[model samples]
Target: MDLTNLSYEEGLKELESIIDSLETGELTLEESFNKFKKGVDLYKYLYEILNKVEGEIKIIMEDEEREEDFQLEG
Candidate 1:
């Protein structure tokens, strides 16, 4: 699946739908496998997004800490 333009919320919604469908036991084995694979891709994409955001937050926090330290020293 080409998730190049997919937002995190959209991907998450799709993953949830996949899980719901899988739970119903309605799809054939092949269909289930396909959904499973797509879900994995969505999960990875979401994880990467979260990790990037976390890293950015950490950087901002570190910068704030440095500024505070500099002010104290001055």
Candidate 2:
């Protein structure tokens, strides 16, 4: 499957499948390494998306808090 083009949920599902395949001890060494690489890429992509979302939320909360403080001091 093309992990790069996958949606977040689809990428996560595919990563889980790769883990299961590796844990089964059925694939050859090369195949295992390839799956592992794909899993890592998926993980990195998900992490980046989550981090950006978190950062945006943090900025919004900080702005709200500043507004509240100004209201209190006015």
Candidate 3:
């Protein structure tokens, strides 16, 4: 599956489904391992998206703070 094209919500939903499948103990060993790896990849993708958004938020907050400081000194 192409995780790169998934939205964060979609990736999260897929991960949850993978977890439920693993919990069922129904897959062959190879299939379980493959699903596990895919789940990990989805986790990393979601994490990267979260980190990027967090960085953007920090930058915006910093800019706002600087603007407030400048206004106070004006």
- Which parts of model 2 are misplaced by more than 4 Å? 1-5
Tens-digit per-residue lDDT, 1-74, candidate 3: 78778999999999999999999999999999999999999999999999999999999999999999999999
Evaluated at residue 54, the lDDT of candidate 1 is 99
lDDT of model 2, residue 48: 79
Q: Give the Cα RMSD of candidate 2.
A: 1.9
TM-score of each: 0.95, 0.82, 0.95
Writing each residue's lDDT as its tens digit, candidate 2 over 1-74 gives 45557777887788799899999999999999998998898888888778988999999999999999999999
Give Cα distance to truth, residue 19, candidate 2, Å. 1.1
Each model's lDDT comes to 0.96, 0.88, 0.96
- Which one wins by lDDT: 1 or 2? 1
Candidate achieving higher lDDT, 2 or 3: 3
In model 3, the worst 10-residue window by lDDT is 1-10
* Candidate achieving the largest lDDT: 3
Clashing pairs in 1: none
- TM-score for candidate 1, please give it: 0.95
